[model samples]
Target: MRSPKQDSAAFTQAPEAVFEAALGVLQNAGNMTLLAAHNGGRRLIARERPKMSNAKFLDIRVEGDAGAAQLHVTVGTDPRTPKAMLDGKANAKVLKNYVASVRGAVDESSPAPASPVADHCLQKKTEVPWADAGQDPEIELDGNIRAAYGL
Candidate 1:
């Protein structure tokens, strides 16, 4: 049985910024959608754009606060995807790009904004259109993502 990929990173950037960078990558992916954002926007889940490729999803969790963050990402194959589907190194490539983008590899990081500005930016980014979810069938799990964690 094929399994999804998993990767994680610790960041000095604010949790909000790291999460936003991740959000940026997925938004521009053109083949993914925001599936869920919960725990005060500290966690997110997104699935591949429908009919685009093998049914896959990204589950991201940010642990920490303003001073630092640890990001955990899980790229999973949907139950609907076939077991015989050989993904080659596609998962590796995706993991690399996603981490780079979230870690600001592709974009320069300016000093964080001032308190008021930062608050505004945080509010804006966390208020995604699809999240509470984009278009995945598991849309109902939007905010309750950490049920296993017993949050």
Candidate 2:
């Protein structure tokens, strides 16, 4: 379930790069485990240490074009646990701290623009050797050979 407590920020970087920054921030936050990450979709889900008294989770979503990105973060507590109470003050503080940390980490570690060399590498294509080009690429063995080798 999505939390009502959410925050968002925009950056002058790619969505994928921002996603990586979010992962790093979560890791450094300690006790946060990445549950799911979709690089193509630019989304990440993480859970706080289950052992903690206040069990919580985070959902980070990224969207952007080639030049800019936006990150949305949602923080929520475990709905199944009856002990998890909704405290406005606590939730607000947690969300605030999380947003601040995420922003700081992204600003510090976001990937720089691709260099000319990197751009060239991304654009380049290589041709495979003719001998290996039209082959199955999988090794095939005869049943007799397998049996002889101890099938």
Candidate 3:
């Protein structure tokens, strides 16, 4: 019978499975887009099953209307690459703050514009109208994130 460590080693050797799991995590979270996984990581898309190792890490970026954010999930060795796991702790603390911002915005009233632009300008900001109140400056995690060097 294979030892537990041996079993783990065999599992880690399966890079395709790791990649799929990582992708599943992101897809479950919410808004996310799958860019590409190729280059030294190239031609990866062509292969039906792209294999990776502990030395290889997958970088995923989520793009929103405002900007983008990156999540680097490791294959093989590092299991803490999932965004929810990596950012969950911080998000847990911060999510309350986010809810508060939304609440405050919903409660506050905006001043009446001198010009209604009603059916005139043809361009009215209905979505995120209250987003300018300094509540949350659009959480653009990917564009603002940088991998820790030497990690």
Candidate 3, which segments miss by more than 4 Å at Cα? 1-13, 39-151
lDDT of each: 0.57, 0.55, 0.23
Candidate 1's residue-wise lDDT over 42-83, tens digit each?
666776644535656677877787788888987755544565
Return the clash pairs for model 2, or none: none
- Scored by TM-score, the top model is 1
CA shift at 70, candidate 2, in angstroms? 0.7
Model 3, residue 137: distance off in Å is 27
List the candidates' TM-scores in order: 0.63, 0.62, 0.22
> After superposition, which runs of candidate 1 have C-alpha atoms over 4 Å from their true positions?
39-41, 49-53, 105-151
lDDT of 3 by residue, 68-148 (tens): 222232222122233332233333332333223222322233111111111110012221122222221221122321122
Ranking of predictions according to TM-score? 1, 2, 3
Q: Could you give candidate 2's per-residue lDDT for residues 86-129 as a string of tens digits?
A: 54444456678776776776677432232111100000122222
Q: Cα miss at 32, model 2 (Å)? A: 0.6
